[model samples]
Target: LLAAAERGDYAEYGGTSVTWAEMEAYFAQTTGFRRPLPWEPGEAADQIAGNIAWAEMNLDAAFEAARTTGWLDLDQYHQQRRLLIHQQLLRTAAFEMPAISTEEARAHYEAHLEDYALPFQFWMRHIFLSCYETHRVEEGETPTSIAEAIAGDRAAALEIRAMNHRRLVSGWDVPVDEIDERVGPLPAGFRLLVPGGPDRRAEVRARLAEIRESIHSEADFIAAARQFSEVEVRNRGEEIGPLPQRGEEFLPELEEIGRTLPIGEVSDIVETKHGFQLAMVTRRTGDQHRPFEDVRESIVSALRRERRNELMLDWMRGLLQGRGIAVDDVSSAEFAAADASSERVVARLQGEDPITLGELRANWEGLNAAQRARYAERPEEYLLAHLLFERTDVLDEIAEEESSAWMAPLLHIYDLVTVAEPFISHQIAEAAAQITEEDLLAQYGASPERYRQPARVSYDEIALRADPPSASPEEGVPDPTEMLMDQLAESLGSVNSLGAFRRVLAEYAIDLRAVTASPERSSQFRDVPLEAVPIEVRAHLASAEPNTVIGPFANQRLVRALWLISRTDDYLPPFEEMRSRVSLDVQAQRRSTLNTQWRSEALERERFELVRPDPLPAPSEATEP
Candidate 1:
C-alpha cells in the first residue's frame, strides 16, 4: 500500500485515489517538514508513505462502515471539502498578485499624505505623587459610599504628606542619593505623620514655588524629582517621550503644559483630583510629514493587499454574473421573516438546482454568534457573498486547475479524520469498558498522591453595607461609617461565645445568610479549598482556631466578619469514597495503552523503522565587512 501510494497509482477506499503529492502533504502536516523527493537520499519518504498507507486503510474502513450502515452524509462532506479547496485556490491566486511599481507606491503615498503625517510630540518627565489608590471591586458587588469616603480621607492625608516630603527634599543641597541620608530613614506609618497639615492644595503650590526658585535648569528639576518623586522617575536617567500631544493619553493639564511650555522650561503646579503635578518640557517637535522613502516599502505592501482584495471581489462578482444570479434584489427582511424550514427558492443558476430558503438558513445558522451578528448587520451583502460561494461547481473546477499540490492531500486527510472520528471513539470506548474494579484499585494504590485532597475551611460570615459617606465630614467630625465600625468592633470585643456573637449580629440587624449566598442561590461556602479563598481572608483564616471570630475586614464595597466553624488539612479519602474517580483513571490508562499497542502493531506489520535526521550545523561568525 505504501509503494502504491508513493507511485501515485493507489485507487481504493470507495474510489478515493492517493498520490505522492498527497503523501508529501501528509508528511508536512505530521512532521512539519517536506518529505524527501524520490532522488533525495533519506528514509523520510518511506516513513511518510507508511503514514499515508495507514490513513488510507482507516479511510477505507470508515467508508465501508458508512456504506453498510448508511450513517454518513458523503455529499455534505464533499461540499465542505469543495469549499475548503476553493478558499485555498483563492489564497493562492491572491498571493501571486502582480508586482507593484515604485511609481504607483509614490502616487498612493502622495494622495494619502495625511496617513503618514507625524503628530506634534514632545519629551517631558515629572515626579508623580498619587494621592488616591485605585481599588478593584469584588465580583457581584458595587462600590459603597463609606469606602469612597475612607479612600478620600486617605488621599487627603497622602497629599499633605507628599507636599511635606517635597518641601523637605527641596531644601536639601545634597545629591539625589544623599538626600535620603539627609532626611533620615522613614519609620513605619510615616505617611500618616502629616495628616492634618495646612490646606493641602495651598501647601502643594507653596512647595512647588520654593522648588522652582532652586531649579535653574532641566538637570536641577530632574535632581529635585529624583529626591522627592513618589513614582520611579528617580532611577530613570532619561525623560520619557516623544509622546503625542493627545488629551486621552495624558492628563489634560499635563498635555497642555507639554504643548505650551518652552523647551527646558518648567510649568506652574497643575492641580488634578489625583494630586498636584509639575512638568518640564525637555524637547519638542512640530507636526511633520513622514518622508516617502522612509515608508515606501510599507506603502507598496498596502497597495498590494488592496489590489489583491479588489481582484478577489471582482472574481467573485464575475462568478455570480456568469451563473445569472442577481443577489442585489434579495432583501434581508424577507429572509428574516421566512421560516428556516421553508422550501421557497431564493436564487438559482440556469440548468442547476435552486438555492432554497432552508439551505440559506442552515448555512447562516452554521456561523458562530459573532460571525452571525456581523453578517446580520449587512444581510444583503452577506447574501450576495454566500450566493457566490454556493457555486460549488465553479469553485471545484478552479481549485482543480489552480490550487497548490498540498491542497488535495489536506482535503483528503480532513475528510478521513471527520469520517473515522466516530469509529475511533467507539473503539476507544470498547477498550475502556474492559477495565475491572481490581484494575481501578491497583491504579489508585499506585498513584496515592493523585487521590489526596487539599486543605479546606468551613466558615460562617456576616456582611454589612459599607457605602461611602454621602457627605464629607466637617472638621474634627468622624465619618459615619467609621463611627459605626468602631461601635461594632467594641461590641464584638466583649462577645466570648458563638451564641453571643450571633446575638450581637442580630442586634446590629445583620443577616449572615442574605449576605454570603452565591448567585446560584447556594448556601455560604463550606469546606472550600484554602487556595480558592480571597488572599486577605485567607491570611486571617490560615492560623485561626476553630470557633474564632475574625475579620470586620472591609473592602471597597462591604465589611465582612467571619466565624471559623471547622478546618481540615490535606488528606486522602477512603477507597470507596474515591471509587468513581479511580475507575475513570483506570479507563483512561487503558485507552492510552490500547492506542500505543495499536500503533506499535501497525509499525511491526509494515516492517517500518523511523529514522531521525542529523541536526543542521550552527552558523559560524561572519567576518567584519
Candidate 2:
C-alpha cells in the first residue's frame, strides 16, 4: 500500500474501460514491443494464451505512465539512465579506497623501526705513503735503529727519483727504445715518460710539495688537488668516499684516523706499505635513519594499499553473500586442478548451481600474476581458495523465459544498465588522467623533504698510527693513549707532505711497519652515510671542511691524525625530473582522502540487502510482489 501511495498509482482504477487496442498501443510506445491487433489476421492464441494477456496490459500501463506523466523525454530519459549507471560503477572503486590516520601510521612505524636503520658508513679520502721505499745510506754510517734504516732507505729513494727527474728533464734525452736500458728497466708499477710514473716521480714529488705548502697556509686541499694531483679523482678535487667499515683493502694504520678525521682538513704526509702519502679527511658519516617526516608518507601509502585490498575483499564477499552465493560446506565436491578442461565440480554454492573448474578457469586470464599465484599458480587448485562470481547473460536469460512477454520490458531496462557499466573503467582513467604538470609540481612541493638524496661526501683521509710507549702493562708501562698521542704530535710537527711525513716517522723512531701507511681505506670512501659507529669520529667528521685536519685522536693503544679531502652535501632534484612518480603519489593520496569521505557519505545513500537462499526459494519459484 505504501509503495502504491509513493508511486501515486492508487487512482488508476477509475472508469476501467481500457481495450486490447489501447493496451497494445501503450506497450508498443513504451516497451517497443507489440502483440497481434484485435482486427489483424494474426493466429489466434489458444484460450490458455488469452489468460495472460491481462498481465501484459497492467505492466504496459505502468511503462506508459512513466513515459508520459513522469515527463521523461525519450532521448533525455535514456541519457539520464546512462549517467546513473556510470555513477554506480565508479562508486565501487570509491568504496574500496580507505584513509589511514597519523596515529595508525606511527604505530606501524614503531613496529617496523628496525627496518629503517641504515648501516654505519664513512666518506673519507686519504693520501697513501708506502713504507718500503729504499733510502740511500751515508758511507760508513751503520744504521743504529729502525728509524735510521728507514731514513736511509727514504733518502735513497728520493735521490734516485731526483736523478730520474733530472734525466727526464734535461740530460737523458734518450728515445723510448733506449729509456728502459738507461733506467735499469723501470720498476714494477712504474712506466717511464708517462705522467706520475718512475721517470716523473721527481716532478710528482715537487708538485706535491707545492700543494703541501699551500695546504699549510690554509689553502683548500680539494682546490689544490684540482690544480695538482695526478689521479682521476683530481678531476673531482681528489675525493673518494661514502665508504663503510672495511678490512684488508683498507690499511690497518689509517682506519682510526679516518673515523676521527675532521670534515675538511688536509694533514701532513702519512706512510704505509707503499711510500709517502698526502691525505685529507674530506667527510665522515655515521649510521643513517631516514627522518620521520619522510618515512611518514611511505607508511601512509603502504597502509592505504593494504586497506584497499582488504576493503575490496570484504565488499566482494558481501556482494556475493547478498546474491546467495557461498560455498556449500556440506558438499564433498572438489575441482580436478589437473584437468581443468573437464569442467569438474569444484564446490556447490548456496545457489543450486555448483561451481566448476572450467568456469573458474575462464576468469583466470583476467587476474594479475600475483592474483593468479594465489591459486597455487594453478587454475584447479586456485578455484578451491577463491569465491568468484561467474558472469551471465541477463538479456539472453530473460529472452528465453516463458514469461518473457511480461518481464521483457523490465529486463530491457536492466540490460541497458549492465552493458553500459563497463565504461566506468574508461571514465575512471579519464578522471585520473586529469592530473596535470601543475598537480605533479604541487605534489612535489608538499613532500620536498622526502625527495632529498642522502648526504654524501667525497673525501680523502691521512691516517697515522702511533705506537704506545711501554713494552708491557705488567711492567708499569706509560698510558698507551698518551704515548700514541705524543708520537703523532711529534711526527705531525715535522711533516707537511707525504715525503716529509715518511722522513719524520723515520726520525721519531716510529717503525714504518707499525703504520697502516696506505690511504686508510684507499683514496676515497664512496657515499658513506651520516650516522654510524664511533660517535667521537662522526662528530669530528660532521664539523670539518676541505683541508681541515681534525685529529691526533687516541683510541685503545693507537693514535691517529685526520685530514679533510672533500665533501658533498645532500640535495634534491627539480619537479620535472620526477614527474611520473610525483603524479602517482599525488593521485594516490587524493584518492585515499577523498574516497574516505565520499564512501562514508555515499554509503548512507546506498541500497543493499541480502536474502538467504537456504530458507527462501529462487525468485522464479515465488510469486511477484
Candidate 3:
C-alpha cells in the first residue's frame, strides 16, 4: 500500500475526493500545498482506478436514495448535496498526508503549553469507620423487641462497616503505600457523602487512610492485596494505574484527599460517607510546557481536520462552478418566473393543499369518529388529560386567533418579544442570531417551570400471610377475616370514596373487619390477619387519604382493615440551598441559547451565498497563523 501510494497509483485506483473547490483552495491557502485540478493530465484515469471510489460510491448511493424517496423535494435535494460535498472532502483529505515541519510543531506546542499541564494533586485511599448517632424507637416498644429487630438487621450493617475499615482505609496519620485499587481520585465514596453534616467529615476521614497508603512503596501490602482483596478481579493481580487528579472525579472523602495531597507522599485517611480511604502517590509528574515534539501528533491531527474541511468546500465549489445549479435571491425568489407560472407550485409553496369541499368534510368525519372511539374506551378523567396534551397546539392557535383587540396587540407584542427570535430563526436560519439577551431573558422568565422533580412518596408496608385452607370443615367457608377481606376488595374497581368502600365490607360475610390506623402507630396492629379485613381498607391505607374507613374482614376468626393516617409532601430544598445545582442548570440553558442564536445569525446574514461565502476566503483565516 505504501509503495502504491508513493507511485501515485493509489490516487487513480482509490483515494480521497471532494466536490467543494473553495475548501480545497482554503487548504492550499492555509498549508501552501498544491491543489489538484480535475482537468489536469491523468485526472479521469485516476477517477476510474483510484482511491476516491468510496466517495463516488457514496455519492451514487445518495442520489439513488434521493431519487427513490421523492428527491424532487427541495429540502431532500439540498440535504443530499450537502452530504455529497462533505463526503467527497473527507475522502480526499484523509488519504493525503500533510507535510508539516518539526519547527512548526514546536512553535504550536509552545503557544498552547498550558493545555498539557498535570493537575497538582495526589489520589489516595484509606480504611474508614463511621460514627453513627443512635435513635430510639417510639417509647412503647420494649428494649427486647428493639434488640431482636436489631439482631436481624444490625449484623449486616456492622459487617459492611468492618469491611469499610479494612478495605477502604488504613490507620490514621500513617503514610500510604500500595493504595487499594478501589481507592482513587473520584472514588465511589465521594459520590455518596451526606452534604454539610458530621457524617460527611467522618466519611472524609475513612477514605484518607487508603489515600495515604497509595504513595509509598509497600510490597507486603500489595502482595496481600493480590492474595485476598475482595474488589472484583483483584485476585487476578492486575496492575492499577495512578488515580486521575480532578476532585469532582471521585465519589467521596477520597476525592478531597486526592485534590489536596502533596505530590511526593501519602495523604492521611479521608473519611467519605461510604468508607475510608488512604491515598498514596505511586508516581508524580509535574506540569511542564509541552515541546513541539510532544504535541506534534495533536497539531497534525488538527491540521488534517482543517484541511479536510477546506477540501470539502473546494469539492462543492468545483461541482457548482459549471453545473448550472441556480437559486433565486431570498427576497426575489417569491416572484421567480417558474414559481409564478405554475399554479401547482404556488399552491404547494403558499401552504394551500388542493382539496375539494367533500374531501375536507370526509377528513373532519374521520377525525370525529376517532375522537368518539377514544372517549368510549378510556375513563373520563384520563381521557380529559390525554386530550389536554394532544390538543394543546390547536388550543394555543385558537386562543391566539380569538384574542380581543385590546388584548391581541399585547399578546402579539409579548409573543414577538418572546418567540420572535426562535420563530424567525426557525423560518430563516440566520435570523435566530438576532436574538438578544433581553429577548432570551424575557422568554426565560415567561417560560414554564422546567426544573421540577417528580413527586415521590416514601412509606413502609407490612404484608400478612393469607391462607384459604385454615377454615374449619363445619364452617363450609374460609376464615371470616380472609373471606371478608377478599370479598370487600373485589366489590369495586379502584376504590375512590371512604363510604363506598365501607358499604362493600358491610355487604360481605366477614369474621373480622379491616381498619386503617395512623402510620405513626401502625406497629400496634402487626398481628392482624388479612382474611378478616376489607380490600378497600387496604387500598385506602396504601394511598393514605384522610378520613377513610376500611371494612370488617375475617381470616381464621381474625379481622383486618386499613387506614391512611399520615402524609408528607414531596420536599425539595430551596433554590438558595441548592445554588450549585441551580447555577449549573441556568448556565447550561444560557450556553445552549447563545450557541444556537450565534449559528442562526451567522447563517442568516450570509444568505446561502456559500459555506465559505468569501470567494476569497482562506483556510489560514480560521485560526491564528
Candidate 4:
C-alpha cells in the first residue's frame, strides 16, 4: 500500500488528484525510512487494511460536515478536511500518546535534586582599605611580612592609618571571602563611628530611629538607604543571597555578623579590605527538611508514572500471554543451548563456580581504559579478589547467587514500557513509512530556491614563527647597521618571480617554503606568522596577486608566496544528490498531517457519557428571572 501511494496511487482516487502518496513519501523520507516495511512480525496485513478504513471514515465524516456547514471557505475547507482526516487516521490506529502519572514525575524529581538546591553561594558586600601601592614601594621595606612592615615603626603605622582614612570615604565594596588570606582578621577599628565622634551619639540614635520608620517596605528602605547609608548598594538596591552553607563557607567574624542579623534589620558597619558596609538581611529562610506536603504533588506525579507503567506492563503481559505478540520465556537450559559457542567450564575447586563475562567485567574490568592501563601497569593497588577473574569458579558463584534473588523492580518496569504500546508504536512506524520516492521528487520540485551553493574562494599561506631569544641566539645578536642593511638588501633581491623565488634559496643559502591556495580550499597559510618572514618578503606578498610572486624582504628568514584564484563552483546539487533532503521535507509534512489525522480519529472514537446537556442556566435567563 505504501509503495502504491509512493507511486501516486491516491492521486487518481479523487476529483483533483490530491497526491496523498506524495504526502506519505514525504513522511518516510523526513524520518529516514528508505521504504516502508510490512507491519510487525505477528500483525496480519488485514490490520493495515482496517487502519486505512478508519482513515477513510474520518475523512468522509469531515467532508460531510464541511458541506453541511457552509461557513467554511471552499479552498480552506478542503485543506482543513484533508488535515483533519490525516490526524483522525493517526489516532484511530492507536497512535495517540499516553499520559504520564504523578509517581513518575516524583521519581524523576528525586533523581535531580541538585537542580532544586539553592546555588552554593551567597552575595556579601564589604569595604576595603589598604596602603597605596606607591607608598609600599617608597617605604623601602620589601617587608618581612605585610603585618611586620606595617607594625614595625611609627612611620609605617601612620601610612596604614592614613590609607584606611582615605578609603573610608572612597573604597567600593567587595566579597569579604575574597580578601587576602595574609590580612589575618578584620580589625575592630574598622567599625562605623558616630559623626562628630564622641559628641553625637544622640544624633546617631535619632538617625537609626528614622531608618526604622521606613523598614516596613523594601521600596521605602531603598529610598532611605540611598540618602543615608554608606554601603555600596547599587542603584537598583542590594541583592545579597544565596548565603553559603552554614559551617563550611564563612569566616568567624563574617559568619557571626551574618547569623546575628535579624530579618530586615541592618548591622553596624563591618569592615574588610574594601572599607565599611552596614549589612542588612533582606530575606532569610530557616533551614528545614521539606515535608511531604511540600513535595506531595511531585510524589503524586511520580506515582502516576509508576502506575501508568504498571498498567502498560499489564497490557503487554496480556498481549504476550494470548495475543501472540511474544513467545514464552524459555528455560535456562534451552537458552544455554542457543549459545553453544561459549565454553561450559566446570570448576574443579570445591564450592567454586564458572564466572560470566558480564559479572567479571562488572566487578573488575569495568575500569576506564586509562585506569585499567594504570592497573595493568601496577596491579598492586587493587583488591586481591578483583584479580581472581582468571579463575573459572567465579561464574558458578554468580549463577548460584542469581538463583536466590529476584530481578530488580526497575528492570521489570522498563520491560513493560518497552513491550507495551506496540499498537501505537506500530502505527507511528506505518505513518513514518508512508513517505516515498515520488513524494520526495514532488517536494524538491516545489522548492527549487531552497537548495543553493554557498560562495567560495581559494587562497594559500606560508607559515613561519619568529624565533624567540632562546630559540634563535642569532636573532638576539645585535648586528652592525652596515651588515644588517646589506643582509636586508640581499634577502629582498632573492625572489622576483616564481622560478626566481624557488632558486633564490640555493643561490643565497636561505631556506624557504612556498604554499598555494585555491578559493575552494581552507588555505593553510592564512595562520602563518608574517613576523617570522623577512620584512620585505612579507610586505611584497601582502600586495601580490593571483599567480604572482614577490619576495626577499629581510627580518628573520625570507620567502615568497605564490597564489592561484579559482572561481567557485557554486551550483545547486543535482536531484539525486539532494534526495535525502527532499526525503526529510516529505517526511515532516506527512507526520504533521498524520498527527492531525490521528487526533481527529481518536476524538471520533472516544465515547463520552454526559448526563446533563444544559446543567448551568444561561446568563441572560438568570438575570431576567
Candidate 5:
C-alpha cells in the first residue's frame, strides 16, 4: 500500500493463502486506492502502482457505471435460467392417479383371462441321436493318393449318422475320449456336449430320420434318450421341461414339433440346428385356464403398466405432433463414417431445429461397446428417442405460461440482491481505510473461526454391472448377479499394481462407461457417497493410497474393482498457504457490515411491504468482496 510502503509495512504472501497479517496488505492493495507494496517484485510493484493510481482517479465513476448496467443484465440472465428449468418441473399434482382397487383389478382379470395364462409350456422328453464321427480315410482311399479327389458325399455321411442313431437306440454310445482323440479337438460352435460337442447338420438330419424309424413307443424313445442325447437336457435323459411358448425363445423346428405332436405318440424326425430329435408329449399344461388367484398380481401390474404407458405415450405423441417433429433416416454405417468432430446435421426436428452428428455420439456415449452395437441395429429408435427427450427444448410454451406465478417472487429478490451489490461495495470501500490498520488487525484476530477448515477428502470408485447367466434368458426369472464379482475375486484376489488391476478388469469384462464418470488418474469419487459403495470395498478405499487396487465387492447386481488413486485428507492449510484466501475473507467481512447498513437505508427509502418469512441466522462466511 502507498501509505504502508512510505511507512515500510510490506511482507511476503500469496503462494497459497493470505494469512491474518498479510490480509491487511491485500486490503490496502485491492481497495484500488492504495499504491503497490514494496515486497512486490521490482517491475510488478510499479506496474500495479500505476494501475491503482489510474483506478483511484475514476473509482467512483466505475462503480456508478457498473451499478447502472452490469448488475441489471446479470439479474435478467439469472432469472431466465431459473425460468427455463422451473416451468419444466411444475405440476399441479392433479394428473397423478390413485392406486388401482382390488375389485377393478379382478373385474379386468375376468375379461382378459387368456392374456394372463402361463405360456404354452410342455412337460415332454425326447431322444437325441447325435452324429459324432472320426472322419477317417475310407478303405478304398490312401494317403499316397492325396492328389486324387476325396469323397464329399452327403449320403455316405448320412449313412454313418443313421448307424450311430441305431446304436444309441440299442443302448450304446462312443466314449468322449476316443472321439476327441480321433477328431483332433472340438471346434467353435460345438459346446453343447462335454469334450465332444455338436455335430454337422447332414448327419443330424440322417440321425433324426433313423430315430423316427426306431422309436415305436414312449418306452423305446425314453430308452434311446437315456443312452444318448447332448446339451443341458442330457442329464434328464433329453427332457426339456417348462417348454417355451414364444416362437423366438426356441428353435422353430422344435416349437412346431411341440405344437403338432400327438398326446401319446412320438413326433416325426425334427431337423433342428442342435441335432435331430424325436419328441413325445408326456404332459400338456396349456389347454386348461389358469386360476384367477395365481394370476391376480400379474393382471393388476399389467393394467397399471398399460395405463401409465398409454398416458405417457399419448402425451409424448401430442408433443411431437404439435411441434411437427421430423427425422432424417441416417444409416448407422453412414453416421459412423461421418466426421466425428463436425457438427454435420444428421436430422432436424420441428422443421427448424438441427440435430447434429456430435450430439448423436453423445446420445449413444452412455452405452458400452456391446450396447452400442445392439442399438446400431435400431438406429431410428435410438435417434428419435434421443431427439425427443435430450436435444429438443420442450418447455418454451410452459415457461411463458407458468414461470411468472412460480418464479416471480424469487426473481424479484434476486434482482434486489444483484442491483444492491455494487452500491454496498462502494459504501464498504469508503469506510475501509477509515477503520485503521490496528482495528483491522483486531477484527482479524477476533474471527479465528473464519479460518477453520472442515475435513474433506477425495476418493475413487469402480462400478460394474454383473453379467446375465444366459445370453437369451427367460423373461421372469431373476438373473445371476455374480458374473463380475466372481471374476474379480478369482483374477484380482492378489493384484498389487495398477497395471495388474487394469488387466484384471479387462479379463473380467468390467469397463467404465458411466455417462458422467471420467477415468481420471486420481480421486474420482469426491461427489460419491461411502454408503452407495459396497461395504466390503470401503475398507480398501479407506486404507489404500494412490494406484492401489482394492476391490471385487458387490452392491446388489453391480460388482466393482476399486482403485484408490489418491486422497486429500481434511486439515486446515498453514497460514502462509492460505494468505490469499484470508485476504478475500477480510474484504468479505467488511462487505457484510456494509450490506447490513445498506439494507436499513433501503427499508427507509423503498415503499414495498416485505412478505418474506424470517428464520434464525445460520453461521456462514461473509460474502467475498
Candidate 6:
C-alpha cells in the first residue's frame, strides 16, 4: 500500500491530482529526509503513508474550497500554486542524488588527514586534599552567646592557620603555629593562627608539599597518593588517564600542569576549588592521526552527504541555465531605480515569455517584510532566482527519474501546506475582525488589576570597601574601619550634595574602585532599583526622602552611602493608554479560538486511517534474500 501511494495516482479530487511521486517530493522538501522504500517496509513507511494520505485529503478539500470561494479562478492563486509545484519538483530531484563510493571516502580522508588528528593524551596520577569538611550539629545542641563567639573565633583562626600553612610551604621560615609569636605579633584587628588547632586542609596541603619534596620516583608518588589522597581512586594508585588534552574528567588545573610537566616527575602544589593537588604525568602521548580503518564509516557518511549537496547544486544550476535566468546580467542599481509598475523586460526565457520588471515587482511585493529587506540591496538577484524557480518544466524532467521516488511524499506535504495556508490565514483574519473596541474595553475592564504597575524607586549608592585591611596595622596604628568612620563623621556634617560627599571621600584618600574585583562590591551604583537595594540599607532608604543623602551605614562586609533619587507609587494605567495592549491580548485569545475551531472542523471533514505494518521477523528466524 505504501509503494502504491508512492509510485502511482493515489488520490484525486476537484481536477487536482496527488501521485506518490508528488507526495514523496513534498515530504523530502519539508522534512529533509527521504520516505522509506517498499523493500524497507516498517513503522516509518506506515507513518509516512498516513501523513501523505491526510495531506492529499486536505489538498483536495482546499481545491474544493478554492472553487467554492471563487479563488480557483484567481490568477494570483494559480501563480502561487505553480511556484509551489516547481519547488516540490526540485525537492523530488534531490532524492535521485548519487551515493558516495568507498574509494571517494578514502580519497577525502587522505586529503584531510589533519582533520582526523587526535589531541595529546596524558597518563597521570593525582593526589588531592579537599578544603571543606561537613559538620553536623548534635540534635540537642543549642547556640549560646559565648559558644557563638567561640565558633566565630575558631573560623577566623582556621583561616589564619590555612594562610600561614600556605606561607610556610612556599618557603617562609616561620612555623605555622608560631606566626604571631615569631613575626612580632599580628597587627590590630587581625586574628592569630590557632596553636595546634585542627585545620585538616592546611595539614593535608603541608603533607602533600612534603611528599612533593621527598618523591624521587613515580612509585614513591603513587605510594604517597594511595596513603594520603582523599579521592576514592587512590586505591588504584590514584591513576587518572589516558586523559585527553581537555575533557570533563580532566580538571582544568590538572590539564594545564599535565601539558608541560615531564613524565615521571611530580608537579608543584596545584590549587583547585576542591582542594590542593599534586599531579604527576606517568606517561604522555603526542597528537597523532587516527588509523583510517577506525574512522572509515564516518568518512563515508560525510562524503555521501557532501556529494548529494553538490548534485543538488548542479541540478539547480541546470535549471538556471535552461531557463535564460542570468541573474548577473540584470543590474541591481537599474532594477532598484525602475518603477515597480513599469513593464520593462529584464530577461527573455528560451521559448517562454520575457520576465517583466512589473512581474518581478509583483513577486517581490508578495514576499514578507523580512524577505523584502534581505533582498532590498540585490532585488535583481532575488527576482531572477524566483524567476528561475518558476520553471516547473525542468523540475518535472528531474522528478520523472525512478530514483526520486523517496521524495514524492515530502513534495506532497509541502504542496498541502502552501495551498492551505492562505485559506487558513484568511479564516483566522476574518475571525479576528469580529473583535471590536467594545471587546477590547471589556477585556481591559475585566482585568484592570493586571495592568497595575508596581511602585518603584531608583537611587544612587557608594559601596565602601568590603575587604579587610590588606595588611594588619602595626602597633600604635588605629584600625582602618575605625579611622575611616572617624574621618566620615567629621566630614559628613558639611556634606549635603553628592559632589560634596565625593570630595570628602576623596580627601580621605578613598577612590571609587571595585572592592576585591567583584562588581557586587563595586564602589557605586546609579539609578539602581529599590527592589535590588541591599537588605541592610533598605530600612534606611524606606524612611529617607528624595534628594536626601543617608548613611555610612555599616554592614558586616560593606559600608554604604545612598542618595535617594526618586520613587513612584503603584497605580493602574488609564484604559486609553492601555488600549493597544488590550487589543493584542484579545487578538491572541481570538487567534487561539480560531485555530482550535479550524483544526476541529478539518478533523471532522477528513477521515484518516493509520495502517500498521506487519511486525518484522526475529533476527534468528530471518532468512537472507
Which structure among the candidates has the greatest TM-score? 1
Best-to-worst order by TM-score is 1, 6, 2, 5, 4, 3
lDDT of 2 at 229: 42
Please provide, for model 1 over 161-201, each residue's C-alpha lDDT reduced to its tens digit, 9 standing for 90 to 100.
34345323334344433444454443322222132223554
Candidate 3 vs candidate 6: which has greater lDDT? Answer: 6
Query: What's the true lDDT of residue 356 in model 3?
Result: 28
lDDT of 5 by residue, 478-497 (tens): 34455445655777777776
- The 0-to-1 C-alpha lDDT of every candidate, in the order given, reads 0.62, 0.47, 0.38, 0.40, 0.51, 0.60
Name the lDDT value of residue 32 in candidate 4.
Answer: 48
lDDT of 4 by residue, 484-517 (tens): 3344346445444445443322222211101110
Task: Give the poorly placed runs of model 3, Cα more than 4 Å off.
Answer: 1-98, 119-217, 220-241, 245-256, 259-267, 289-294, 307-625
Query: lDDT tens string, model 2, 1-625?
Result: 2222222211112222223333343344344555533332122311112212222233344446446765235576556554434323323333746888999998998888887776555565544422233333333322122133433332333333333362223234544443334444232323111112343345445556665776752246655554344343333354566564455377644656676656566665654433455666666655666667789999999999777755654564454556665532212134323334655565566636777666665666677978756654233324433554233222233234423454444334342222222222233344666777778877789898877766555444444433333145677766545655666676577444544433332233332233212212213354576553156566677778755555678555435565555656678977777777788787777666654454334322332111111332446846677
Residue ranges of candidate 4 with Cα displaced over 4 Å:
1-136, 139-147, 151-237, 245-259, 271-276, 287-301, 304-625
How does candidate 2 score on lDDT?
Answer: 0.47
Q: lDDT, candidate 6, residue 130? A: 61
Q: What is the alpha-carbon lDDT of model 5 when measured against the actual structure?
A: 0.51
Which wins on TM-score, candidate 1 or candidate 6? 1
Report, for all candidates in order, the number of backbone clashes.
Answer: 7, 66, 127, 57, 9, 18
Show model 6 residue runs off by greater than 4 Å: 1-112, 118-287, 290-298, 309-393, 396-412, 461-495, 500-545, 548-562, 601-625
RMSD of each: 14.2, 25.6, 29.4, 23.7, 22.6, 16.4
Candidate 2 minimal-lDDT segment of 10 residues: 607-616
**Candidate closer to the true structure by TM-score (higher is better), 2 or 6:** 6
Clashing pairs in 5: 2-35, 17-577, 17-578, 17-579, 17-580, 18-578, 18-579, 18-580, 19-579
